[model samples]
Target: MLISRNIKMADVIHMNYFTLSVLNRFGIELGFGDKPVEEVCKKHNVDIDFFLEILNTFVDKDYFPKKHLQSFSVKLITDYLQTTHDYYHKVKVPEVESLIENMVDSCYTQKENIILLKKFFDEYKQELLNHTHREEEVVFPYSLAIEEAYQSETPDKSVIELMNNYSIDIFQNEHDDIEEKLFDLKNIIIKYLPQPKDTGLCNRLLFVLFNLEQDIIDHSRIEEKVLVPKIREMEEILVKNFAKK
Candidate 1:
């Protein structure tokens, strides 16, 4: 397997909110009441009943249990925002404010800079949007499916083995795209602003950029280093057990 082995279940699960928020932002909303398990389980080649059990566990834990979990419509798109508050406050917002400050100072004052900054942020936003979608629609759901399989009590190895076919189409591709976007942001910051010697505005911009970089790095670390491995493990185990038939 070309997949990283250090990926953890916690990583992907933690990112569930991130994906949901991203989808919500893009208007591709999903909810528990939407029959996500039925749709997603089918995509990932997992059993629906087993998948429901996992959802119920989350419900018991009150992970996102709205309307008393039981009353919560399974089809309703639950609030799935991940815990990126620290990342947003500590990194993303500061960096963005800084970037905005820089734009106000430089771009507005300088005609060409305005166009450049707009273009940059526009592209940046697009990349992020795409990244979140893949995670929500593919990676997170696939991981959920695997979690269901891994935890299943079925004695029939084949029943437990279905996770091997776990497929989150386009997840890997989107990962690459996100990595490239991070690099692009870094390169732009490095190339466009050498030093914040001008004023507090430049300093602010640099801060924002730095924070965005941190968030992405943190996000990627969670996804690549933590989530990927666990999913892969689930897949591998399922494959082996599935072969027992």
Candidate 2:
């Protein structure tokens, strides 16, 4: 995203210990553990400048990608996207479910609407899982095939035909719809719903939704601006060559 910071690599972990997620977002492992950020970057082959900009995006919601794939690895981005999907399905979604349970039990007086909210969140989770499943099962595998084919000196014509048949643009179309459900869930909780008497429970539910919103925003941007663009460019090259042949 935006490269608003000129911070040193060693200083990043110090800025926010929780920022290790940023490194994970870049497909960098945290084997560094308590080590300096610079050492981690060096070990991971992470470009220092890229790491800070990505870190800034999470730190500040105002950050936007000025030039998304420049000097970035498509494989790394895809790996990071997959990691994010795993986090969503495993950690984020389940955490929301746990909070919903806590809210329901703690606020029995307000169980009806909270149950409805939980039902809605369940559907939302299914939608998200299906969306991610499509990416992992179809889009990503096809994209990787294209990357392999196009990178070769003599690209595979059959592979080009295969990748061309299933377009990334298809996924792009409904990305907003998937995101809209989250927005709907958040709004329902914030405005229209009958909240529980336990203010902490209500607040916890809202907080989880808020964090999910921000995470999804960054996740979508990477897919839209970085991964899709790179794959599209490769698709264009492979198709053009296949046509000439």
Writing each residue's lDDT as its tens digit, candidate 2 over 171-221 gives: 677566567888998898888977678888778778878888778887777
Q: Which of the numbered candidates is closest to the native, going by highest TM-score?
A: 2
Task: Tell me each candidate's TM-score.
Answer: 0.53, 0.81
Superposed by TM-score, candidate 1 places the C-alpha of residue 125 at a distance from the truth, in angstroms, of: 0.8
Weakest 10 consecutive residues, lDDT, candidate 2?
1-10
**lDDT for each candidate structure:** 0.47, 0.73
**Model 1 agreement with the true structure over 1-245: per-residue lDDT tens digits:** 11111333233234343333332322333333434334544544544442333333222333221222232111222112233433344446446745665565554346455456656766766666665665666566666666566667653454343443545333444466354655666576667744434556655555556655654554454444334555566667766766775
Instruction: Identify the runs in model 1 with alpha carbons over 4 angstroms from their true place.
Output: 1-81, 85-102, 105-108, 155-174, 177-179, 193-198
What's the lDDT for candidate 2? 0.73
Clashes of each: 21, 0
